[model samples]
Target: MLEINGLVKHYGDFTLNCTMKVEPGRITGLVGENGAGKSTTFKAVLGLITYDAGDVTLLGKAPSELTEEEKQKIGVTLAESGFSGYLKVKDVVPVLAALYPAFDREKFLGLCRKFGIPMDKYIREFSTGMKAKLKVLAAVTHRAEFLLMDEPTTGLDVMAREGILDLFREYMEEDENRSILISSHISSDLEGLCDDIYMIHNGEIVFHEETDVLLNEYGLIKADEEQYRNLDKEYILRVRRESFGYSCLTDQKQYYLENYPDVVVEKGSLDEVITMIIGGEKL
Candidate 1:
């Protein structure tokens, strides 16, 4: 349960205008390439950065209006910030317990062991993947009802990413009303985990859709010059050049499937959709 409406932020040259929503009991993904305002949006939502304009409501109150206790209810795993490097993994336990009243210290320690995060080692000495797991573990084990995670699975191997995703699933299973808004460049991570997804580019929200609809209804059409000319462009959302001729993106996969039997149509994965939406020419 987070909602952002025309939330505007500006740096020297870059400006981010983002709008998104996370529903109760859902895992919503904010997906985009690097420097695409994913981190900026998160910062604004968490009140770590001041936005130029627009509204941000987190857990039913303005981000800035949220009290310390209210903030404790929202788990955050930010890419740009974390615990002091001098502290050992074990050293943060008491710190977290003091910060979060509902923190499950035993469960946190258990997760560290499960994820191979050495409790005795200095956090600065941990590998990137290890640090990532530690961040995710901190966010999830606190029993926070809402999670705002930016690149939570970064530096993790495929199996590790899956394990972390499974942890999120387990977190939600424990509370039916819990919600998560996560951002990741890994399309498969969002595709497999998110119920709904928002695609961001150049500081703006480009697309938001249900994962099921995106996977099942949206499609890519590979067509030669002749096939392209004959095909209906009504549903074509974007197009790009290809060695063969032209590749088209459409939200109506079944429409083309039934109408153009000769053309090559394939389901649009999240990666393909992003490639077309951000790189291809809009129709």
Candidate 2:
């Protein structure tokens, strides 16, 4: 439902070049470190920032060409910047209803209550998890067709994170055309929730793959210098030398398991894969 081609943004020394697509009915993830351009890409797609180069297609039209009605079809929740913290939950409902014609006040209030947000107090009194929940509630309460969430689960406890993810799953199941693009520092959450993942580092798209392939086929092998030299390096994508041995990442897990039966090979986690891609040496 969204496409970005050769998208480039520059700010003096820092440059961002990203290209990826988010298909309908799937949650796509963008995982990166701080200052890695995840937010920049999101802003460009939402038309909040102008890019130096390339095209961004949101829904069916260019982001800049989207009409107000079309804009309502998309929802966004940033890590920061939202309704005034001084506003009470009761006070914000009217504002939201006024902003979007499809705003479901009943559903919004129900979610707030269900999630244990107090309506009588101002938003400023809520905790970090409460504030995060409020943002997602606002985004989906309008029944948006697409969602762009940046760090939706940051600073949340395990239970809170699970609840928010469940809400996302429910939202997606409610409509066959819905899609979400979520960026988060928490790699495990993305590993579990995303259908596809795009890894970004130093403002570049380093890797993009289906989550199933990544979890099932990707592996990390620990080998010493002698063993590493003897194994087929063709399957090794990146390698980092540790105190004990070499930590290697590979996409050909089954091949390595069959060929190098003595070496220690284990399934790769999202964090391990990202670490190798960003910091380890290439093949």
Candidate 3:
């Protein structure tokens, strides 16, 4: 449902060059460390910032040139959204609802109630978690088909986070035409929810893979010098040696599992993958 081709955005010292596509009914996670250009890429996609080159198409129309109807079809919850602190929750909800043609007031109010958000309280007085919840509530109540959420679960407790995730799951099931692009530092949040992951580093997309493939096919191998020497170098993506042994990252876990049954093949997490990428360690 979304296509980005050779998207290039340049700042004075950093640049973002990325390419990816999101099909209907899929959740694509964009992950990277702080200042890794994750937010820059998101801004470019939303046309909030101008890019030097490349094209961004959201549901077939360039985001920069999207019509009002097209814009209504997409919902965005950024880290710093344009919500005035002086407005009370009740006032804010209706104000945002009026901007969208398909907004459901009842649904909005219901979500607020379900999340225990006080409708009468000013946004400035709410906790960080409450503000985050309000932003998500505003985004989803409009019934947008595409959601670009940057850390939607930020400041939320475990229960609250899960509830929000469940809401996204339900939204997907309710409409097969919907899609989402979620960027969060919490790898666990993306583990089960994202169909695929796009790992960004130094303003470039370093890795893009299906979530299942990533979890099942990738592994970390820790071995001694003798064991490391016995293994084929071609199979290792990165190797770091210590006083006692070496730690290696590999994509071909099955190969090592079959050949070196004695070698340890522990499953790698999304956090590990991101760490490796950010550290400039091979793949």
Candidate 4:
């Protein structure tokens, strides 16, 4: 489990103030645009970067206070860095076995083979999907209880991405105590995998919701200017003007379905919800 309270980081122009928690046995996702501080938050949690304010607790201790043995309980895969493309996939087996006492060589090699990674082929010769799969394989095969993954499925095709996700699901099922905090640009990826979602923008977390609630209860209401004037506004969270009239985002979709039968109400997708929250006029 990981907990971050008031974690703040500042760059020249952007200041990141993030507070989020990843519970045991659950997959939590962070979604935001470029420069939205998803990576900054992950780095702070993993002690890869220094923060200006707040505290971070990882696996029951402050990130800085975790011992060497304690560090082995966590796994990491970053979009920005990892394995040297100069070496073959087989080349890192010994290095990993030497680093982690619990490294499962058999499982690692199995995952690599399952993902179609050529053990004899140099990493540089692999495609983007192969590289991404290799990174995730390395993270999970170490018997780590917690994972901090930044864009593990980036640039991957649909099948490749699903394979990695299935790996995560398998990892969690093997141990209910395990947890994963992942960030992705792909909405469908998060929608399919995350238990809950946190939306961050401009270096701040703006919304958090259970995935079921978000996908099931949330809706967008399309109403013209006349309908908008008469429609109940209590449940509406955001409103945006369209040439057709107004597009409103609401969490209580059932409430409107029962009260106003004429307005067009459509179930909200993750992308539509995020777009509306970031760009629409909040009520």
- Model 4 / residue 149 / CA error / Å: 0.9
Off by over 4 Å in 4: none
Give the candidates in order of TM-score, highest first: 1, 4, 2, 3
TM-score to native of every candidate shown:
0.98, 0.97, 0.95, 0.97
Model 1, residue pairs in steric clash: none
lDDT, model 3: 0.85
Q: Relative to the true structure, how large is the alpha-carbon lDDT of every model?
A: 0.93, 0.92, 0.85, 0.92
Candidate 4 CA-lDDT value = 0.92
Which one is best on TM-score?
1
Q: lDDT tens digits, residues 1-283, model 4?
A: 9999999899999999999999999999999998899988988888888899998999988888889899888889987777998998788999899889999999999888788889998898888888888999999999999999999999799888898999999999999989999999899999999999999999999999999999999999999999999999999999999999999999999999899999999997789899899999977
Prediction 2 global C-alpha lDDT:
0.92
RMSD of 1: 0.8
Candidate 3 residue lDDT tens string, 67-138: 888989888889766479899987876677778979999998999999999988888888999989988888
Off by over 4 Å in 3: none
Better of 2 and 3 by TM-score: 2
> Candidate 1: TM-score?
0.98
Q: Looking at candidate 1, what is the lDDT of residue 125?
A: 89
- Model 3: pairs clashing at backbone N, Cα or C within 3 Å: none
Every model's Cα RMSD, please? Answer: 0.8, 1.1, 1.6, 1.0
